[model samples]
Target: MTRSLHDRHRAVLPDWLALYYREPIEITHGEGRHVWDASGKKYLDFFGGILTTMTAHALPEVTKAVAEQAGRIIHSSTLYLDRPMVELAERIAQLSGIPDARVFFTTSGTEANDTALLLATAHRRSSQILAMRNSYHGRSFSAVGITGNRSWSPTGLSPLQTLYVHGGVRTRGPYAHLSDARFIEACVADLEDLLGHTRDVAALIAEPIQGVGGFTSPPDGLYAAFREVLNRHGILWITDEVQTGWGRTGDHFWGWQAHADSGPPDILTFAKGIGNGMSIGGVVARADVMNCLDSNSISTFGGSPVTMAAGLANLGHLLEHDLQGNARRVGGLLIERLRAIGAQLPIVREVRGRGLMAGIELVRPGTDEADPQAAAAVLEAAREGGLLIGKGGGHDTSVLRVAPPLSLTVAEAEEGAAILERALRAV
Candidate 1:
C-alpha cells in the first residue's frame, strides 16, 4: 500500500521534498508517543514529526479544541476580530520577554521568519543580516538567504544580504579546542571585527539551538555576550525558537533563556509544536519594531479560529501540566542514557541536547569525519526495530535527532533509548 502511495507521491511532489527511510511507511494513526504505519506496525516516535508534535499525537485537549472551533467557525481571515486569536496572542505577549510586545501570526516557521526579516530590515533601514554558521532558519526565499547550512539553502538569490558568523557549533569549529569562555571570546571578537567591515546590519538572527544543524548549541552565555556588542550598534537580536521553544530544551522555558543575562531578544519567532501538529507560527516583537511597517499586512490563514483554538488549548495544557518541568526531568535522564550508549560505540562522536531534544552525531570509527552513511544505516535499522527517529547535520546529515513529545514519559524514553541502542549496534 505504501509503495504505490510512494510512487504517486514521487510523481507529484517536489523532488526536493525528502522522505525518511528507504521504504517510507505511511503513518495511518498515532496515540501518545507511538504511531502505526499502513502495515499496522507500531513504532515509538522519537523525532515527533521533526519536532512539530510538541505535545503528543492525538492529544485530546488539542483535538477537542480544534473540533469545537471548526464546528463553530474554521476561519474568518484577519479582517474580523477573533477571540481565540486575541487570547493566544495575549498569552504569547505575556510569555515573550519583550516589553510592550506585539504579536503577528503566520502559518509556518518559514512565514514567521520571513515576517521577522521584513520587520528587522524595515525598522533598521538595512537589508543586511547576521546569521550563525550551521544554522537552519526556514525555507522561504528570505529565510534561505540568512540560513548558513548549505544543504538546506537552495538559492543564492535573496532579499537580504546576510553574513555568516561562528559559534553555533561548539565541538567542530576553529575554536573547538578552546574552553567555553575562550570560545565565546573568539566568536565575540569575530562578530566585532565583522561589524567593523559592514554597515547597518538590521539584525543578528540565530536559533538558540541550531535545530536542523543537529541540535548543536553554543555556550550558555554566548548570545548574551553577543547581545552586549549588538547593543553598541543598535542591532536587533532575533531568536528563532521554532524547535526549541515551549520547554523542549529541559533547562529553560525558551532556549534563549540559557543566555538570559542580557534579557530577551528584540524579536522572537516560533512555530512547530505550539499547536500540536496544527499549523501555527508567529512572531513577537517590541511594539516599535513590529509597527515599523508603513503599510498593512495580513495572513489569510494565519490566525484562523481553528488554529488559534488549537494553540490556546495546547499552550494551556503545556503550562498547566508544567510540561517544561517534565521536559527537564525526563530529558536529563534520556540524555544521560544516550551518553552512556554513545560511550562504547566507535561510530558515535558526541551526544548533546537539553530537555526533550537531543542529537547523537555519527562519525567514522577511527576518525573525526562525519559519517552520513552510518546515520542512514542506523535510521533504517531503527525503523526495522519499530522505532522512528530523524537525521540532520551540516552538508552531511550525520546526526541522529531524538526529540519526542514534551509529555514523553520516563518509560517511553527508556524504551526509545533501548531501541536506539540496538539500532546503533546493528549499524
Candidate 2:
C-alpha cells in the first residue's frame, strides 16, 4: 500500500523555498520541553525556540488564556485600546520597576527595536548611533544598520553613522580571565573616545547579556559606566533585552536589572519570551523619552488582544509558579555541568553566560582558534541522541547555545548534559 496524495505533497515540497538547513526530524507537536516528530520520535528541546519559550511549549494557562481571548476579541487596532492590552502594559511596567514607562507593543523583536531606535533618534534629534561590536539587535533596516554584525546589513539600507565598542575577548578556559573591573574600564574608555570624535550621537544601544554574540555577559560595572557616559553626553541608553528578558536570567526579571545598581536605561526593548513564543514584542520608554515621539509612530498589529492575553497569562504564570527562582537553581546546575564537561573535553574552549542563557565554545585540541567542524558534529550528534541545541558566535560557529525553559527539571538537565558529553566525545 502507498501513502495518500497529501503525504506525497508534504514530502515533495520544494527544498529551495525553505532556507533553514534542517535536520531529518519533522517536529509535529510539543508540550513543555519535549517535541515529537512526524514519526513519533520525541526530542528534548533544550534550545527552547532560541529562548523564546521561557514558560515552555503549549503551557496550559497560556493556552487557555489565548483561546479565551481569541473567542472574545483577537485584535482591535491601537486607535481604540482594549482592556487586555491596557492590563498587560500595566503589568509590564509594574514588573519592570519603571513606574512611568509606557509600552509600544509590536509583533516581533525587530519591530520593537526599530520603534526604540526611532524614539532615540527622534528624542535626541541626532543621526549617529553607537553600538557594541558583535551585538545582534534585529534584522530591520534601522535595527540591522545599528547592529554590529555586518551579515545582517545585506538589505542595502542607507548607511548611517554608527560606532562600535568592543565586547570582552574569549578566554581559553571555562571562564574568561579578565576581571570585571578591567573589562568595564576598556569598554568605557572606548565609548569616551568615540563620543569625543562623533558629534551629536543619538543613542548607545547594547544587550545586557549579548545573546547572539556568543551569550557573552559584559563586565559587572560596564552598565554603570556606560550609563554615566551616556548621561553625561546626553545620549539615550537603549538596552536590547529581546533574549534576556522574561525571567530567563534568574537574578532579575529583565536582563538590565542584573545591573540595577546602575541607572536604568532610557529605553528598553523586549520580545522573545514576552508571550512565551506567542509572537509579541514591546518597547518601554521613560516618560521624557516617550513624550518626545511624534504621534505618527503606530503599528497596525501591535498589542493585539490575543497577544496581550498571552503575555498577561505568561507573566502571571511566572509569578505564581516562582519560575525565576527555579531558573536560578536549575541554571546554576546546568552551567556547572557544562563547566565539568569542558574540563573533560579537550576540544571544549569555554562555558559562558548567566542563568539559562549559556554557551559552550568548541575548538581544536591545542589552540584558541575556532573549530566549526567540531561544533557542527556536536550539534548533529546531540540532535540524533534526542537533544536539540543551537549554534552562535563569529565566523567560527564554535558556540553551542543552550537556553532551555525555566520549567526544565534537574533530570532533564542531566539528560541534556549526558547527550552533550556523548556528542563531545564523538566529536
Task: List the global CA lDDT of all models.
Answer: 0.95, 0.82
Question: What digit string (tens of lDDT, one per residue) describes model 1 on residues 73-167?
Answer: 98899998999999999999999888999999999999999999999999999999999999999998999999999999999999889999999
Model 1: per-residue Cα lDDT at residue 325: 94
Off by over 4 Å in 2: 1-24, 155-159, 168-178
User: Model 2: what TM-score?
Assistant: 0.93
Candidate 2 least-lDDT 10 residues: 15-24
Candidate 1 local Cα displacement, residue 47, angstroms: 1.0
Clashes of each: 1, 0
- Backbone clashes in candidate 2 total 0
| Pairs in clash, predicted candidate 1 | 250-355
Candidate topping TM-score: 1
Compare the candidates by lDDT and give the number of the best one.
1
For model 1, what is the C-alpha lDDT against the true structure? 0.95
